[model samples]
Target: MVNLTVTQLLRDRALADPEGVALIVQGSAPLTYGRWDERSTELANGLVERGVTRGDRVGLVFGNGDWADYAVAFFGVLKAGAAAVPLSDALAPADLRFMLGHCGAAGVVHAEGLEVAADGWTVTPGVLRAEASAQTSYDGRSAGDAVTDPPRPDDLAQILYTSGTTGRPKGVAATHANLAYGCGGKRRPFAHSRHLVHAFPIGTNAGQTMLINALDAHPAVVTLPRFTPGRFAALIESYRAGTVFLVPAMAIELLNAGIAGRHDLSSVLLLGSAAAPLPAPVAAALTGAFPNATITNYYTSTEAAPAQTIMMFDPERPGSVGRAVAGGRVRIATPQGEPLPQGETGEVWMRSPAAPRSYYGDPGSGTFRDGWIRMGDLGYLDPDGYLYLVDRESDVVKSGAHKVSTIHVEEAVFGHPDVVEAAAFGVPHPVMGTVVAVAMVVREPVTAEELRLFLTGRLAPHEMPAQVVTVGELPRNAGGKVDKRALRSSLTAPADLAPAHE
Candidate 1:
């Protein structure tokens, strides 16, 4: 009966709508609320019998099982008064090793196929679920005999690692209050529809957000384990999903692949994008593709859950991410840590009730101060308080005395008809201090000179990339964002990179 815990929420939904489809993964069986609650209870009781104590950290490694499996393990861990640690099925062996060791998990509850290598563990609840099918005696216990313990509102619910764009991923310790707010509660914006769809992968912050939202928002939560633009569009039609979510990278693929055109997306009423800013070009294309739908772009970080900025695509203010939502505040500050004038670009800081998170067991990033987070984004706020991002402060290139937005250059390159993917970065230069460079993936033949010419009108003379390297593919992180750091460190580093003309 804990109001703030995920366990209580799932139980309420199970009692109210036992037969409602709670989860659906591509090519797998649907899991109803009743079954979801039952499996979680069973697994929870099993974990308790196997000696998983309150506050114990249990890793979830569902490895390609239905997303429902991850869901069951997540709630089960919470129901047992244990914190859930979701392991990405896509993580490298080293990353996986680091997480397992870093969290000091007492046990791991993984699918039959998934495995984790760690030195020692006090428990391994994998056998608990593995033995469930054969143990009728295990489920024969009275309702009161199930796990009697559940996490409190302020208890650690999960530890999500950053996507690690710049360096090592840091674990974000979130309490039950943090993850349980939007779920199984009064309906909110994205959750109001009967069906909700998104292709977010497991282990990413956005994926965890959808998981939290799925509890009570929609009657059906349709998910794509793997996202191809065409597959993403087809699923919307197949399920007649009214609301769907896409990150910027996914949105770009949908537009360039022309997938939404191939499907009957008439059922879509809301097409939302998050994780990163939706490129102006991508935003425009989304509007055209889902003409019947309201296209929205949201800006928020993993650590700053529920506190976000939302915009419904205003062509007049193409770059604006919109004003802060309810309970959220945004401010622009100068590099010297002073508030900047409206319309002046500077470091962006945001604050909300949900912004009180800290890095678990690692030196803090110093991004979070007092009640606000630095956001690490450089942008301006208009007199009306609408926010517009220019670029990440660390990622922008210094050209001569002025800073150039690689995002701007990349957006222009993405606008090229033949370009499927593009990235812009700073390179060492003798006279200009540093110059802009680009790497791109194209579907058709296009000369570097042609692309260079294309940017002349779209970007300032100083902002134009001096070198462009065409590639078959651009590196991407598991969360689906382009790995700009990886790109900069690759053999294509501007130092020795050849121009596209060569």
Candidate 2:
């Protein structure tokens, strides 16, 4: 087995080119590998001195503005042989508290100027870095003395909390082996670019993936403080970033704001969309926006990292999310965990090449079985092995005897020229038990009757939306995914009377 750890990659990079730029936040100075290594080493030793031990979980609370420090803290936790639990500054205080308690965190490392009150010890990265400096200068001690035992490949590296759309957030624990599975290879990920730009917020799986890319990929990772259409476009144009990554919501906003019309984004050679499926319409618009880039959609969950189906936008198969690549396998299975036939819709399952991740406190979440992770998605595999997603298992509308896919309904709504974004979900009905309903955002004013007319031939009799509500924006979770549960709660009024719709 090829044994590797996450810190090993960073160490190799720091040794190879100490002066090379490693990370950069927009409007901030660049962070070099030499400094990243030095700072993280000191912080690791400081953490070890402050009672952190192997297998202990440390909480990292940070915002996008402090991404460089967050990066250093992440490596420091690994180097200290402690599992890092990262949480966003944007998360609610209650949620943050819940996650910290859930993991029984040993200590907390928060960003400067941010207030996080944990039951255990809490310190900012600046404070840790300062204390390390004092110890080195006054005591003439090296950080390596404290961190005698470096982390091994099998050691716990991180515990990331999921965006709790259903119940309380669950912590997913991953080992150093899981995070460093695909690294230490001859070919670098995103090798076509000098600088790769993205606006993914800190604490999400997508954000962590970009963090790993910063350590392993050839490109210098560039990110904005936050995702605004104008700011994101400006970063791409200014950096002439050959590689870019974004989710569907950002893609919709960029297209709606006509960012490509105003900015020179032709330098992008590889554009990746993740977090959620890229709607066909948005994917097509991205092709025009980044004329020189290959628009790719990646499908993977937080539990199934490094195991994803990658689809380069193909006009012939626009709806497919592509086949599993890079030693990952995809399968459609029944609820009972039995494999289903091709073209048969069922639960989606994926397996990674690395050690499978599991829930931290609760081992039997039923999401992971053997080595495969249940995706909680309903999809079917075509003859060519491409996977086509229908909808979330919970989001699928069970209208009496007929089942409705929200994706199909939304795709039809996106076919209209006026529609900017749309979300479809199930609504309770007396006669049908549950019926299809839609919430949409459009560029121009359009009534429910007009949308019904637009979807008349596009949908079947049962597939048509029973109610259509127009909203200025769709509610999103921390991970930037549309919160269907929130939408369902908001549309609890009279069915005939649509909210914000005439």
Tens digit per residue, CA lDDT, model 1, 1-502:
1246777788888899899887889889988989888888777777777677888888776543458888988887887788888778788989877887788888777765656665544233446555443455643655333555556788888988888888888788888876776555455445546788898878888888878767867648788778888888888988888899988878877887887668988888888898888888778888788878988988988777767899989889888888899678889986545788888889998886652676777545677777777788899988888998989888898888778898788888988988877889877665676778888888888876798788777988778787778888888887778888877766343554333221
User: Tens digit of lDDT per residue, candidate 2, span 10-115?
Assistant: 8888999899888999988898887888889888888877889898999999999888999999988888889999899999888999999999999799998888
Task: Itemize residue pairs with steric clashes in candidate 1.
Answer: none
lDDT accuracy of residue 458 in candidate 1: 91
RMSD to native, candidate 2: 2.4
User: Which candidate leads in TM-score?
Assistant: 2
Maximum-lDDT candidate: 2
The local distance difference test score of each candidate is: 0.78, 0.89
Query: Could you estimate the TM-score for every candidate?
Result: 0.92, 0.97
TM-score of predicted structure 2:
0.97
Task: Point out where model 1 deviates above 4 Å.
Answer: 1-3, 63-65, 121-126, 130-145, 188-192, 334-338, 363-365, 430-433, 491-502
